[model samples]
Target: MLNIALFGPPGAGKGTQSKMLIEKYNLAYISTGDILRGEIAEGTELGLQAKDIIKRGGLVPDEIIVQIMEERIQTDTEVNGFLFDGFPRTTVQAYILEGLLLKMNTKLDCMLSLEVPTDQLRNRLLDRAKKENRSDDTEEVISVRLKEYDTKTAPVANFYKEKEIYHGIDGLGGIDQIFERLTSVVDQTLQKSWINLVLLGPPGSGKGTQGRKLAEQFNLEYISTGHLMRQEIKKDTEMGQSAKTYMEKGDIVPDEIAIRLIERQIRKHPDANGFIFKGFPRTIVQAYILDGLLRKLGSVVTSSINLDVSTLESIKRLTYRGKTEGKRLYDDTDIIIHRLEQFEKRSIKVSNYYSKQDKFEIVNGLGSEEDVFKRLTDVVNKSFKKIR
Candidate 1:
C-alpha cells in the first residue's frame, strides 16, 4: 500500500494534486476540513458542536478532530491506501496520527511536501477568494492564517524529515510538470524501500545472468566481485595487482584483499537504491566482513539467494559455455567439478549463517530462462514486501 501525507500551506495546489494522485494510485482522500463541512451539512451531533465552536470563534479541540478521524477510518476499509491532508497541524498531532495508524496496522509511506513561496501562496489565495466567493480568504484573514500555519503546521515537516520520509516537491510549475516530479519521487522512494540481496550460486548456475537482469528491472546496483576485480586489475591498482598475482599463480585471492575491494565498490555507489551482490561472500569470513562493512554504512544484507543446480547440469552448461567463449577454465571438466566442490564446501557455512537469520532462499535453477526468472522474481517480491 502506498500511503502518503500531502502537505503544504493554503493555495499550494494540494487539492489539485491530491485528486490526481487518488485517481492514479487509488488512494482514499482524508481531508479534515471537508469531513467537518460534510458533517455540518448533515447536522450531525459532532458537527453541531463544531459549528457552535466556530460561531463562538473558538477552534475545535484536537480530541474532537481525532475522534472524527477514528470514525472515518473505521468506515473506509476498501481503499488501496490513504492520502492524508490538513489534519496534522502540529508535532503533537503528527504523533497522534502515527500512533493511530500503527494501531490500525499500517503506516505512512512518506510525507509529500509541496514547496511554494509565501508571496505566491498569498496571491493564489486572494485569487481563489475572488473566484470562489470565500469570505474567510480575505487578505487580512489569509495573512493571519498563513502566520498561524508558519507557527503551528510548518513544524510537522520537520517531524517527517526526522523520520526520513519527507519528500519535497517544487510546487511552482505547471500542473503536469509538478505531477511528473511527484511521480518520480514516489517511484524512487518505492524502489529504494527494497532490501539489498546477495545472489549465491555455483559456476554456470546463471547468477550472473539473473543478477544483472534483476538489477536492471528493480533499479538496483549490480555488484559482481569478478567484474570489480577484473576492472581493478585492468587499472592496475595496488589491490588489483595483489589479486592479479594470486590469479596468475592459480591461487585464491586473500579474504582481506577481496573485502577491501568490495568495500570500495560499495562506498563508490553510496546512494544506490540497493545492490544485487553477485559472486562475493563465498565464505563465512567474507560474509562476516561484508556485514561489518555494510553496518558501517547503515545497512545489512537482507537476503542470500542460492541457485540450486545439479552437478551434472552445472558441468554440461560450463563445458558448452567454455566451447563458445574459448575459456580454458570452463573447458576442463575436472577443474570445473573441483571448483564446484570448493564452492559447495565454503558456501554451506555461509548459507547456514544467513539461514539462521531467516535470510536464505534456495531457488531452482533448472528451467527456461523466463521460467527461472519468474520464480526468482516471486521470491524477491515477497522479500521486498516483508522488509517494508
Candidate 2:
C-alpha cells in the first residue's frame, strides 16, 4: 500500500491537494479533526467525552486520539492506501503511529511536508475564517496554533526525515502545479522502495552475468567490488595504492581496504532505487560492516543470493575463459583450487550471518544463463513482496 502522511502548518492548502490526491489515487482519508467533529455532531460516547473536555477548556488526551485512529484504520478496507491528515501532531504520536502500522503489516511510504511562508499562512487562515464563518480561526488563535506547530509538530517531520521518507514540497503555486510536485515526490519514493540485494559466489559461478541481468531488468545499480577496485587503482587514490600493493605481492586485499572502496561507491548513488552488490562482502567481517553502512542510510540488505557451483565446474569454466581471454589469474588450476578453498572457508560464516536474519538464499549456478537468471529474479521478487 502507498501510505502517505500530509504535513503542513495551517492554511498550506493541504485540504485542497488532499482532495485531488484522493481522486487520483483512491486513498482513504483520515483526518483526526474531521473525525472528531463528526463524532461530536453525532453525539457519540467518545465525542461527548471530547466535548466535555472542550467545555472545561482542556485538550483531549493522546491516548483517546490514538484509540479513535486505531478504530478507524481497522474499519477501513476498501482503499488503495491512506492519506494521514491532522494526525501525529507530536514526535511521540509519530512513533505510536509507526507501531500501529507495523502491527497491520504496512508502513508509511512517504511523508510530504508543504513549505509556505508564515505570513501567507496567516492571510489564508483569515480569508478562510471570513468565508467559513469560523470564529475559532481568529488571528490570535492562528498565531498560537502556528507557535504550537513549531514547538511540537515540526519534530514529526524530522522523525520521517531520518528514515529518508520525508519530502518537502513547495506549497506556493497554482493548485495543479503544487499537485504535480507532490505526485513527483511520491513517485520517486515508490521507485526507491525496491529492495537492495547482494550477490555472493565463488570464481566463475556466473555472478557477473546474473547480477547484470537482474540490475538491468529491475532498474537497480550494479556494483562489483572487482570493478570498483580496478577503477580505484586506475585513479591511484590512497586506498587504491594500498590495494595495489597487496595485489603486487599476490595477496588478497584486506577487508578494511575493500570495504572502504565499496562504501565510497555506494555513497555515490544515494538516490538509487536499489543496488545489486556483485562480488562483495565475501567475509563475515565485511558483511557486518556492510550492515552498519546500510543502517546509517536507513536501509538494510534485503537478501543475499549465493550461487552454488561445484569446485570442478568452476575450475573448468575459468580455464576455458583464461585460454580465450589471455587472463593469467584463471590459467592456473592450483591457484583456482586455493581460491575456491578460501571462498568456502569465509563464505560459510558470511552465509550463516545472513541465514540467521532470514535474508539468505542459494541457487544452483550450473545451468544455462537463462535458467540461472530466472532463479535469481525469483528470489529478488519474493523478497520485494515480503517487505512490501
Model 2 global lDDT (CA atoms, 0 to 1): 0.81
What is candidate 2's CA lDDT for residue 235?
95
For model 2 the local lDDT of residue 180 reads: 100
CA lDDT of every candidate: 0.81, 0.81
Candidate 2 C-alpha lDDT tens digits along 162-235: 88788889999999999999999877766666467989988889898889999999888898877777677879
The RMSD (Cα, Å) of candidate 2 is 8.0
Count backbone clashes in candidate 2: 0
Total colliding residue pairs, candidate 1: 0
**Candidate 1 local lDDT, 1-388, one digit each (tens):** 4578988888899989999988777678999898889888999989898899999999988887888888887777656568899768788889889877755534677899898998999999999899998887788899898888778866898898898888889999899999998888877766665357989988889998999999988778898877777777889898788887765443457987877777777778767888899978888888887777765564667678999999889899988887775463224666687778888778899899888656789999999998899999999987776444
